[model samples]
Structures are given as structure tokens and as C-alpha cells.
Target: MYISGIGIVFTRGRGIDSFEKALKEGWREPSRTGLIPAYRVGPETLTDASLSKKIRRADRFSRMAVLSAVDAYGNSGITVNEREKLGIILATAFGPHTTTFSFLDDILDYGDANVSPTKFSNSVHNAAASYVSAILESRGPTVTLTQFKLAFQNALILAGSWIAEGRCDHVLCGCADELGMVMECACKMKLNIAKDGKINPFAFSDSPVSVPGEGSVFVMLSKEKGSNNYGKVGEISFSQNITRKPDLFVIDTDGMSAYETGYKDIINYDTVIAGYSPVFGSMLTGSAFNFAAAALMLKNQIAYKCIFQDNPFGAKLCVETSAKNLNEIYCIKICRPEIKTIVRLQK
Candidate 1:
């Protein structure tokens, strides 16, 4: 399968150009106004006056997904001969939990019968996908898969299966998540919250720190190459030869997910390493963000410098942002010391 187009709504900004600008620039500190510092999306970024009536009732979670998915469809610039042939698949770890919290608020403040129907509707995990499909008028199979582990990579795997099974000609696969007050309190109590809001990928310590972050990313996938193609998503594997290195190894080593020390074994190879979790913040869906960066690199044939150059572990890091011949990139996410998900993209 090939990645024809990409749309992203993240902490820095929205759209593919914004993502590329973030990569060229280095890492920035996460927001600190809340109880737990996070990479929360600003209100201005989600403002779409043109589609206000279309998504008037969408909450922040839905807005992120809707806007990102919409951009993914438009970014592809492919006139769908049949809207029914285009499918939608949204992958998320925590889908609209903030809206769920608000719905609970409605039940607590008002009676059960007095709950807001609009809020209840938006609370469902599939609401975002529905909004995307409705706005795009895509009548194909729409799915919402939720998992705390490998959500985006697993979505890619499923997208491949759907294409092979002749379910649809194309699939709009995406991820949406948010950092609400309830979730912030939970992360504060449950995880090691980074005080300065900076995640060090090179800190391969058993005890890793995390600064919670949230946003959405969507990619248009199809078997045939489009005019504006990122690259071909060749292999989606759970287990692969770690010894076989690509031109670049894009590691999703955000401190929140796995044992950081586990990455020590994988980095011993000779391929140049890159990780962009610090820019987006730590989330189970963070691999999608890394995949976006890899896709941009593959499309442009350029290697972005590692966000933070302070490497104590002496891993082969890309220190300079320069033009390079990038033929293949392996975006790997380690759920545990043993479990690994690799997405291979080739030029």
C-alpha cells in the first residue's frame, strides 16, 4: 500500500506544511497551564469557519479528527470516482474521553433524562469517523478501533487487509486523542510526569519520564500510487529482523510507552536514528506522528536532524538537516522489550 496523502493536527500546528516546519525547527516545550503539562491543541488551530455549520456540535476530540481527516481527503487531491469505494478507519487509544467526562458531568449535575443528547452523541468513539464520512460523503465501510498499544500501526495493518479483501479502493486511516482534566489528573497520579515538559528519547533508563500529549493524524492510503505520493508502505510487521536496517530507522521511543532501556539493543545498528515524540508529546498513537515525519522525509528525500542533540548513549543520530538519498525508512514502535511493530516505507 502507498501513502498518497497525509493530514495532521498536532500541538505545533495543523496541515502537512506545519508538520514539516516543526521538523525543520527543533523541539518546543509543552503547555504548562494545566495540572499536568501536555501538548494540547490550541483553540485557534481547530477553527474552521468554512465548516462551522457542518461540524457545529463537534467537541475538541471530534474537531481534531474531523479536520485532520478532511484535510487528508483534500490533500490527496484525488477525485474519488466513487465515494462508496473510499473507506474510513480511525485508530485511537482514548476516544473522546473528555467528552465522556462531560457526559458524566451532565448526569451528575442534571438528571439522567436531562443529559445533553449532542454531548452523548459526540462521546461515542465513532462519532469522529462518522463526521468525516458525512462531510466527505463516503459510503464505504467505516470503522473505529481503539487500543492502548500499537493503535496506528494496527490500523495500517487492518487497512492493508481491507484493501486485499476488496472492501474498498482507498482507506482514510487516522488517530485522535486529547488531554482533558480527568485524564491529566490520571496521568499525574499514574505516570511519571516530566516537570519541564521535555521527553528525552536518548534517556534509555528503566524509569522513564513522560509529558502527556494529545492530537490527531490522518493518512490517505491506496494500493495505486497517486500524483502526490509520500511513499509505498511496503511491510507492516509485528516481528522483524532488527539486524536488517533501512536507510533510516525512525524509532518511536517516547518515554511513556515501553521500557526505555529496551531500545538500547535496537540502536546498536549502523542506521541513522530519529525520534520525534518530544515534539508531539507522549501518547500510544505517537507512532503515527513519527510515521508522518518519515513519510515527509521519504517524499522530500531529506533527513531531518534529531530534535535534541544531547545524546549520552552515543546512538547514531541525524545531527544535520540536509538533502540525502532516502530510499527506505523503517518506522518502528516497541510496545515491550519483545513486541515490536515496524512500518516500512520506500521511495
Candidate 2:
């Protein structure tokens, strides 16, 4: 059984109370018609040591990753044995862009003489993963991935494959992206930043731009289905360089033909979890937010809508099941200009 024990920390809310509040209020920033409500962390919420330790070394992305990882482990309710085989897979669209720009700024201003090695090291895409492994004392495999919008999905597929291949029995999968000065500059330069500085996802538009926000989310995956577990991953698949017909298009398609092809193959699923909003804020790890919501949906046996505006690549949906059947089946259809592929998921 492939299921995720989820943890999430976002601007929309923190912990369960905040999360539920945001959902209940249906908070949406009108200016950024394609983004979710932003969440912010206050100094009072963090200990001095935690705040001070990260001040000089960690970027917004890294901090989010660490906090989300901690939350995920706590929510899983399963203590990881020191000897258990574990793996980590993280995904981000703009990995450590904030820190990367800081290093560049130092070089541009000081010609490298004052460039801090520690800052440089922490700026790497895998820095968050490294810190996570060390903090958890996990010695198993750890890797990071980037695929623009598909990074989290790729991570899930990779994590699942590792389990299927007997590489690990337990794995932690995560996604994180952060807002920074550089990101703000880019948005302004591109003229994509909303005047009101928010993101809206359901608005109808041919060109959709998102506000920038920061957050991270993680999930624990296991091969064995414990009685207390939320749900199991039924199947995961991916396709690159695909081509198919255009009628299947929904809106501003961003390399989503493969996902649509996957959707057509799904037949039994009634609910879908989507991550399109996270990316609207210029955060690449949109799927991480979707993963958090998906876990909740599965556990509650609820179906929810993930709205996308003028989606040309079809909307991403996750179906939840209430029946006590072991062999639930789903079909997904992906289409490109010249190619069509179908995959099936069964559990």
C-alpha cells in the first residue's frame, strides 16, 4: 500500500486550527486572482534558537522545509526506528533561489573575498534535504528533484518506485518553495505581480500570473498499510516529451498533456487533489500543498474540487474511496499533439 502521512505549514494557516479557519473563510486575495491566500510566520511562533540559527545560514526555502518535515513526522504518528530503512525525496521549482541570489550579490559587491562558504553550501538545492536527514539521523538515500510544475509528482513517483524496488520500506517526500527579494524583482520585471499582491486561481484568463509566497510540506510513505494510516498510494506514473490533439486542452497548458493522459485512464476515482494554486504564488512546490490536502480528503472520504482557470491541460483530480475494497482501479489519459498514453492504478 502506498499512502502518505502528511504535514504542512503555509501562510494560509499553521497547524490544524489555522488550516481549518482558512478553509472555512474561503480566504482569497482578489488582486492575484490565480493564487491562494498567503500565510506568514511570526517571531513569537518560533524559538530564539530556531530563529537565530537560521538567520545567517538558511533561506526561506530551507526554513520552510525543515518546519514542514518536523510537522510531517509528528503527524505520521509512527516512530521511525533508527535502524529502519528510510529515504527522502524533495521537490522544488526554484530551489534556494533566495540564497543563490544572496551569494551572487556578495560576489557582485565584494568580488568573492567575502563570500561566506556556509551561505554558499546552504544555498544548494539539496541543502534542505541534507539538514533534514541530519536532524532525523536518517542514513538512507536522499535526493532532490526539479521539474518546474511537475517536481512534486516526480518526487512521489520516485519515492513509490524506491519502495516497489525494495530500496526502502519508509520514505519521506516533500516540496518547498520560498518568496524572496529576487523573486519579487523577477515578478516586477516580468510585470506579472498583482497590483494588490495576492493570487487568484479560479479567474478566467488566457494569461494567468501568480503572486509569490513561501511554504513547505512533507509526507511519510510506507509499504505496509497500518490500521491507523490515512490512506495508501494506489499508483504513480509520468511521461515526458509527449504530443497529442488540442481539443482535450482546457486553458493555459503548462506541460500538462501527460497528466491529462493519466486522467483519462482513471475510472474509479471520484475525488481529485490539485496543486495549481501553490505555483500561482511563484512557488514551484505546488504539489506539496496538494499532497497535504489530498491526505485529508482520503482520510475523510470526501470529494473536493480543485479549480483551475482556462486549463488547457485538464484539471488534476484525486479520487477518494469509502468502500472496503482492496482492488480499486483508476485510469488516466495523457494527450500530446501526436501521442496518447494511458496508465492504470489499482489497489
Candidate 3:
């Protein structure tokens, strides 16, 4: 299936233009708690007037997901009536942690009987996906999955299957995650935070430089080609040995040794190797953003400069510099020594 449209929101901003500019500038915001830096999507991006009355009641995670799906649908140029044929699939490492923790706080402070019912409603992993379907009025299948680092990749596999099986004409597939105080603390305890509070993906650090980040990205995928098609969603697989290398490699290196080890062989390959984790920061669903960036680059026929890499930092693509057709892009997801999922994109 081809990617009809894309709506991405990260630390930089929304849409393709903002993401490309931020990629070139390498902008990131420091956390207030003085922990690792995080790429957070602000709450003010969606105003009260933009959302419906029912959608306004949703929690932050659902709000982000809804807005992203809205943007994806808008960009796809599909009619409102066609939405009934659209399915909503969302993937997240941590779904609405802020709301879940608040519900827990209410139960701990008061009691289960006196806890906030609204908080409890939005605490489940499927709450955000439900809100997306409700806001879009989509009667098609709505599913949510949580698989730590490989959540987004797995979601893509399911979305592709649904389209192939004639289950839905188009699927609004997305990956959304929201960071909370508890999650932030867990990151600090788990990975190494850069002392300078900056992410350098290619830097030779003695310790892992994993920064926490959160955002949402939704893409419209259809079996038929459209004018807004960015690229085609090709092969999606999960294998231990990746024998064939792709034209471009989007490695998910969050400074975690386990994730990094899975890509060691391909990391030093002669083909084009691009890492954007430093630009968007690191999160469980950060691979979603990486896939978006890679698709954008493939569509634009331009590769953004990897600021941290040693040899080629700001080299623009030319016939003399790189290949003519950047056909395949491999997005590899690794949890530890095991390779969980590999999503292949073709232009």
C-alpha cells in the first residue's frame, strides 16, 4: 500500500516542512526537571475550537492521537463519507501514562470508590484508539497495541494486512506516546543521560546517551495510488538475520546497548546510513518518527544532514555523491539481542 499522506508532530513542530527545518537546525528542548532532554509536543497545538465537544473531554494522549489522525485524513483528501471505510490503528510503548498515574493517585489518596471515573476511563491502553475512532466517527476496526520498542512497527504490519485483506480501503495508522514524571524517572535510572544535556547520535560516548522523547505521527495508507502519495509501504518482516541490505538504513539507536547491538552489522555498512534519534531524541515509539523522516526524505529526494556523524555531516545528495534512485528504506526495531520487526519502505 502507498502512503497517501503523513501528519507528524514532534519536538520541532507539525507537518513535513517544520520537520525538515528542525532536522536541519537540530533543535531540542531541555526538560524542566534537569533530567535527560525530551522532545515534547505542546498541548496548545490543538485549540478548543478545533476539536468537538466530546473530543475535548479526552485525555492528553487521546488528544494528540485525534489531532494527528485529523491531519492525516485532511492531507489524504478523503471525504467524510469515506471515513466509514477507514480503520484506526495506534501503537505506543506507554499509553497515557500521565492519566494512568493520576488515576492511581486518586485511588491511593482517596479510595477506589471515590476515585475519578473519568481518569479511570482514559487509563486503558485502548482509550486513545477509541477516542480516535469516536472523533472521526469511523465505524471500521479500531485497534491499539503496546510492544515496548517494536509497537509502531507491529502496528504497521497490521495496518498493511488489513488493507491487503480488503478489510478497509484506507487505514489511519499512528504511533503516539506521552511521557510522565514516573516515566522520566524510570528513564533516568535506566539509560545514561548526557552531562551536557544534548543528544549526539554518532558521538563516541563511553556511556549510553538515551534521552526521553514523546510525540505522535499518523499516516494515511491506501491500496490505490493518489496525488498525495509520499511512497509505497513495501515489505514488513521480523527476522533474526537481515541478509540483504537496503538502499538506506534507519537505525533505532537510543543509546541502549541491547537495541544498538542488533544493528551492529548494518551500522558500519558501506551503503547510506542515517540516524535521526539525536534530532528527535529517544522514546519507545521514536522509530515511528524515524520512519516518517525517512519517507519524507525519500519523497523529496534529499537526505538531511546527520549533525553528529563524523565523515559526512552536511552533504547534500547529488549524482556524484549518492545513488540516483533511493528505492528501499529499512526501519529495524530491536529490543535486545533479538530483532523484533523490520518495516521496509519503497519509493
How well does candidate 1 match the true structure, expressed as C-alpha RMSD? 1.1
Error of 3 at 242 (Å): 3.8
Q: What TM-score would each prediction reach against the true structure?
A: 0.98, 0.72, 0.90
Clashes of each: 0, 50, 0
lDDT of 3 by residue, 1-347 (tens): 98888887776666766777877676455555535567666667654476768686688788778777878878888664776678989999888889989998998999878999888888888988897787778988889988775778888889889988988888999999877778878888887876565665544334658677777889888878878877898888776566686777776776744445445456555566667877767777888888887888778776666656532233221122222367888777666555556778888
Against the correct fold, how does model 1 do in TM-score? 0.98
lDDT string, candidate 2, 1-347, tens digits: 45546666676544534543443344355323223323344333332355355444666677667767766766667777853478888888888887888889889988868897977998899999987787777777899887664576678778888888988888889888775666555655654544554443433323445555667778888888754475666545455222322111112122212233333322222233233343323454554564454455445444333333333434344222232222322222233433332222233
Shift in Å, residue 185, candidate 3: 1.2
lDDT (10s digit) by residue, model 1, range 247-312: 998987777765778777766787899888888998888988999999999999999998876677
lDDT of all predictions: 0.88, 0.55, 0.74
Task: Give the higher-TM-score candidate: 1 or 3.
Answer: 1
Say which prediction, candidate 1 or candidate 3, comes out ahead on lDDT: 1
Q: What range of 10 consecutive residues in model 2 has the weakest lDDT sum?
A: 245-254
